[model samples]
Target: MTGIEAINVYCGLARLPVPALFAGRGLDPARLDHLMMTERSVGLPCEDPVSNAVNAARPVVDALSPEERDSIELLVTSSESGIDYSKSIASYVHAYLGLGRNCRVMEVKQACYAATGVLQLAAGYLASGVSPGARALVIATDVSMADARAGYAEPATGHGAAALLIGPDARVLELDPGAFGLYSYETLDSARPEPDRDIADVDASLFAYLDCLSRSFADYRSRVADADWHTTFTRLALHTPFAGLVKAGHRKLTRELTGAGPDAVAADFAERVAPSLHYPSRVGNLCSGSVYLALCSLIDHLPPGAPPQRIGLFSYGSGCASEFFSGLVGEGARQALAPARIGERLAARVPIGFDEYTDLLAGNSRCLLPVADRDIDLAPYERFLTADPGRGRLLVHRGTKNYHRTYEWV
Candidate 1:
């Protein structure tokens, strides 16, 4: 029964409130409010995905004693925002965190489902009896971006990262070894051929998402035939592109599983799934990290002395792939999460105006330095793109002439 030992998350430090973002974009404020509510905010382009991943995994590494850090046998990063085509972001993350050199490091991609896939693989490795006492570090990091043409999805875009320390102790949710279901197929629902631009066919994508949900949940029920799904699992953690879709997914699940009407479905959702949506509501969508963030939110909001819980997780990625799995939450799960700490971090973010957000987006260089002039001032362009000599971490990608990337720690 491999399970989560410790988990940590980091959202981008800059934000753009929903109202301000859509104020002059010709969107109907009242209609948008009716749909998404007023509390949503998207991550501003303040940091690259690598930095977010590094910052997210830092605390988990810091919590470990030197000996525990050395016991980490695998480091896997799942993201759509890989900085280099040839090098895995896991290597940069390993170097940044100063993890043990003996650890195996790699990156996985299958749209947003990448994290869920890598996590299951890590769990399997730990359960394989290869390293009796070792731990695996899994990271999900993404910074969602939409071009001016992306319309509604531009508002749903978000950026963040979550890091999970997987081991056998299971202070958090203890995963059931054989209880999982997966469904996948080829589809062009969403794509990003350019580094900074993302495009999706909204209607097709939504239809595909719900279809995957139905198929995966049906497979899960088939696998665990004797269990009473509706009553057995007290909570759900669904991948969220927007708050509304998650609610819709829950209602759809209720209808399929129990023949419940809207009233009953709404009641079930309020009691079980709403508590886990806090982060998603606040941060919009965090590509690979979305579902795990929901899990963190669920653990953070549980009532004191609540009995042990069974949590059902649904993960979806846009190529598209989906999985349904369940885990048992132990008594120590609440204490292990420390929800207030995460709340404080979220509350401390600096909000930027829409004008500033557009400027930042326009100035994003994707770390591709200008070929002719190396002396350009990137500070006014994108603060995160600037190379600060004083900072210990710097990533520079010299163009095709050199085909070299240098990571410097001063």
Candidate 2:
């Protein structure tokens, strides 16, 4: 019996809604813009991607007082980029948030699918009754490919993060121990860059990636069938790759599941999914955070007094690892969501000019640049400059950075 036997997601942030930025700094109109024109690859809009990720998570953490953050048994941060391989993102986040040192910090690696894997692992521990009353903290965030010259290189790759505080509660989604599936294929043919490397050739574009996901689903469906599981999964929270990849995979999978005939399950699942794309279009692809973002988006729109919902999740990581899992969205999902407030925050962003975006991009993590004690009202906790770069160390800044920069929950 795990400490917290169920999982309930907090808020999910997709894009930095910079209406001002979008209006002022027109994005490259080309289907995909390679070779960024900005003096620096980093832009203010780019900053918002990460900032918004942290921003989207603020409310969830705020709902829990400092006491809860400190008590989490494990803090798992799954992402492609770590500030430095030697440093732990979980540790950095913990220090920034003033979480207790007692927290077990670890990062997962598996491309976009890493976050789901981490959640599954935590669920297993909980199911075993290992830490009967303990909980796990899972946060997934990713910024754009650092290279400004690549097929996937539009400022389109926005930054963001999603945090889910998992614990036992009869009110939330109950843990389905044997329900989820795990699968992977190994090869570096389509790998994202290592910290020392740059973006690699898109031997497989986003379209090709979707095709891989389709193939994975077909493969997994057969396994489920072989096991004599005849259950039907209705809704799905897909990993947003580019956009609409889910629909593409869904079409192919439903066709396979229903024998290529027009049917209610296939048609209804397609129509019901319109709202899931709301954040993906704006946020672009958040690497690991995509699946949870889609899940959170669905939770926001679900009607009151709705019956329990079963969702199938498809997670794929290039260098190719993919997995599918299922869950029941519990009855108490509504109150725990606080959905409307999150929608309001997403709507309030000011767009940035392309020029300003360039400026922000160039200045990201500027060691020599002066910074003042600015009030980051959207974040939940305090942020402070801990040390000066001159101390013979690679300059670093750290704080309890959650979904956003500060707390405006009051």
Candidate 3:
């Protein structure tokens, strides 16, 4: 079965510590302690989803040999942070990465579940025997911002991206063929129909998440009924909106799957599930990328010389689709990941004051322009400000009438 051959992730450079954010908003200090105890760290932000996807995928593509890069037959981008109403974000990413034009490019949006959907689709495409020796690139990139006016969700919101290179030969995790379960239904627990804001029924969203988790997991168990629930998978990764919710989900899963009492469940979770939370605790919610980010965390923090393990993955998106799947942690998986290096990079991020974050939210110094302006020097735009001139990458305006955009590598 086609599975992840290589994986890379990127978090925003700007870090907003939870305590500082609370202090900035004059929130109670007790709440700060609560967040800290739960291991919440900071949030990251990028100029746009395009940049996030590009930076996340660049390293993985660079690691590839020229022949492997040439063999990429599909590019599927998953996100709700889409810039254009019509054009697929995959097209921008395809050009930015200098991938061949002879590839299929499309965007998937089922809220946060889109990434899982596209991953399955990519696996099916590769397994179809339609294109021998071909590969697919699946990218999950999102930047979720909370409205300062709507203050409650700010602490839970975050931004980041993850890219997975899937093919027949996997050095990382090998996906099990016909070993996935999905449950989807229409619901308005969370939504962002408008560009600038998101609306959610918090209680309803939590209920939906747990419900979907239970149902999808049940479907998974039915498929592998003889498998031992308590000892089958060595690690559990769930879509994390916050550390607390994931804890709750773990407890629920333990009860339903293993019939373990509270004490036993807590013990099992501390050993098996907590390791997966290490990265998400620091990066906040990555929307479509959250579950995959958790998977990355699991690989990054694995112990030395540990035997291969089965990792269970649970993904849920609000408005709302869910899935449960498992992947085998093949040998040499740990050698391919550099969790310590990623931690060091995250440590070097510049922390912003509460005022700066609010200012950014307010668009005070944000580099945005009107749609009618025909003559835009894209080089100076803040979105492209971080582009390395030496790297020969530049953003070019394709057309002014519709803000048609593309990138160039000179």
lDDT values for all models:
0.76, 0.53, 0.75
Task: Report residue 290 deviation for candidate 2 (angstroms).
Answer: 0.8
Q: Output the lDDT of residue 398, model 3.
A: 34
Model 1 lDDT per residue over 62-98, tens place? 8889989998989999988876777787887898889
Give the deviation of candidate 2 from the true structure as CA RMSD: 8.2
Better of 1 and 3 by lDDT: 1
- Cα error of candidate 3 at position 127, Å: 1.5
Q: Per-candidate RMSD vs. true structure?
A: 3.9, 8.2, 3.8
The TM-score of candidate 2 is 0.73
1-410 in candidate 3: lDDT tens per residue? Answer: 57998887777656777777766777677754333222232322224567678777887888789899999989999998776767887888898888988899999998888899999889988989999999999999876646554454567676768899999988788888877778889989988766767788888888999999888877887888665557878998888887678888888878887789989988998888888888787777888888987888888788888898999898899999999998898768877766325666566556667776775565411212335434433342343234333332323333245576534332
Worst 10 residues of 1 by lDDT: 390-399
Total clashes in model 1, counting residue pairs 3 or more apart in sequence or in different chains: 0
Pairs in clash, predicted candidate 1: none
Per-prediction backbone clash count: 0, 36, 0
Off by over 4 Å in 2: 1-58, 65-70, 146-148, 152-155, 170-172, 194-208, 211-231, 261-266, 365-410
Once model 2 is optimally superposed onto the true structure by TM-score, how far is the C-alpha of residue 372 displaced, in angstroms?
A: 19
